[model samples]
Target: MFKYFFVVFCLSLFIRQGLALWCYECVSTQPGCGTQFNWLFHWTKICPETDDVCVKIIEQRSDETIITRSCLSSLRAIRTDIPADHYEGCRPAAKDVHLANYVNNSIKELDIYRNYYDKTTWCFCFLDNWCNSSPSSNAHVYLIIGTSLISLVYMF
Candidate 1:
């Protein structure tokens, strides 16, 4: 009985470690960043330990819109005013942030202009890697866990 418990515990640990949170990282100007986002063209990145959630930023100027996807920590650093309570769902921040910091502090070099922006709405999620993209993003993660459990069961 003790040996069985130890084996189960080890397998559980393995499964947990194999799964890491991933987010769709991209900007509106990039391919697949539009309304009909092409998943194949979108880049998925593992969320850093410091970023516990994925965030989507939508800034609407007079006649243009800008959309950006990144980890919560990244956006928080630039915006700096996201209320701690507004950690999930889509909503406009109480204040509008300037684009100067975002353009200058950006880690990626983009041909698309980011210097122009206005009122912004932010969305945050911790459900799955693509939670920032869609509601059904968690399915694949569940499937992976299911497969791992089956393999472990068959092993013993």
Candidate 2:
């Protein structure tokens, strides 16, 4: 009986690890950051298993504007911020760039855009598949249900 319980516990742990989070990846100055645009260049990337948040930044300057999207650690997700001007010789603190915990599960996305004239926007997404341009239908949910059913059968 003890051995059976141990096996079940180990299986649960394995299933939890297998259902890791992933976020959409893209960076562009044009309108379509996640989608395709005619003149914009976009790259495809997948966040590491350790990352739990997706981040997007849009900044405008005198000469040019930029937009970026990437994955961030859960810890850095709460405290993420971008300096007004890094190219203009403003050095930000080390902690400003690191990832942090997300504040709330219900709050899927956070938008921080202070300047209307420059139109700089910073967005962070904490929910699963929030950043994906096209997400598949409830795949993770099915995996969880399947695992639970298998576990129940084994126990019986």
Clash totals for all candidate models: 0, 8
Q: Per-residue CA lDDT of candidate 2, range 75-137, in tens?
A: 254434654332312233233332434434454353332232255555555555435332343
Model 2: per-residue Cα lDDT at residue 134: 27
Candidate 2 global lDDT: 0.49
The top-ranked prediction according to lDDT is: 1
Candidate 1 lDDT tens digits, 1-156: 655665578677657754666788889899778545566677677777643788888888897877788887666665644656546788875543543444554555552334345677788887655777755445565775776676667667
Q: Best candidate per TM-score, number?
A: 1
lDDT of 1: 0.68
User: Local distance difference test, per candidate?
Assistant: 0.68, 0.49
In model 1, state the lDDT of residue 50.
46
